[model samples]
Target: MAQAPPMNVLEISAHFRVEHDKNRRQFSIRLNGSHDKAVLLYDYVGKKTVDLQHTEVPEAYRGQEIAKHLAKAAMDFVVEEDLKAHLTCWYIQKFVKENPHPHYLERILH
Candidate 1:
């Protein structure tokens, strides 16, 4: 059965469709009728952990808080899956610090 998205995921979807591709280890948003994308990249560590490594938004798509949405989607996935996270990406680190989610923040691995 296809499961429902988490509440935060649903909320973000309303603004932009943040798509997660597990095999690719990235979460991305591509605007409608546009080919560019805003993406957050991560790497799996062991079995239940991830290292958020980088985020990039096309120049044409910058200054719209798209990175923030990507951060939220990726972090929400980490929390929903009960996985530990290592915030190697500066933006993700900044995002977490700015918007506190106790349960999600607790999963950060140092």
Candidate 2:
């Protein structure tokens, strides 16, 4: 059987999208889409530290690690854009802890 094409992460205006399907339900993580929703926001001062926020996933999508994918996208963006983060969001903090990438944290505004 021919294999299905892998889902290429789609980059939106300021975010990335990874679609998902679960038991007839469709969902996705709109990474860095909107700070009011889930996005990367910079500080008022140096504008160096960006904050990441992820809303509680829908009931059907809970415990599915969609947030991790979103976080990874954020981290990747940080590197690609050469930006730093404050990690105000809990999930993002945990992600930085697990990844141990210095590029993101080292540039943090102290």
Candidate 3:
């Protein structure tokens, strides 16, 4: 049997799709080559002020900047819905701290 070739960043990034499972209160991305691979995971607080509770990227997906995409998606959703946000997730907190976009910063719960 032949092994599949490893995906390059552009190839992998092109296939990336983030989905919000509102029922589960999570935002996630499925990896392209592995069924068991969860590229990113983010859970949130669903109250008046949505608190981003946790974020995880499987070890295999780390260093690929996948978490950044997840953070942006979650923050964009919060902004679009006109909801406040609390960055309780350390990864998200760090991402926001580093990127500091005005739109995301404005909605943050200080």
- Scored by TM-score, the top model is 1
lDDT per residue, candidate 1, 71-103, as tens digits?
988888899899999999999999999988898
Window of ten residues with lowest summed lDDT in model 2: 36-45
Which candidate number has the best lDDT? 1
* 1-110: candidate 3 lDDT, tens digit per residue: 98654332222257676767665667777776567444334345565678787778888778888788878788887888898988878888898889899998999987
Tell me the lDDT of candidate 1.
0.85
lDDT (Cα, 0-100) at 83 in candidate 1 = 95
Instruction: Tell me the spans in candidate 2 whose CA falls farther than 4 Å from its real position.
Output: 1-46
Worst 10 residues of 3 by lDDT: 4-13
Candidate 2's TM-score reads 0.55
Q: Cα lDDT for residue 8, model 3?
A: 24
- For residues 1-110, write the lDDT of model 2, one tens digit per residue: 98664444444334336543222122246534543222233232335445554434545555756566666766665677577656666877887788877776674543
Q: What TM-score does structure 1 among the candidates reach?
A: 0.86
Better of 1 and 2 by lDDT: 1
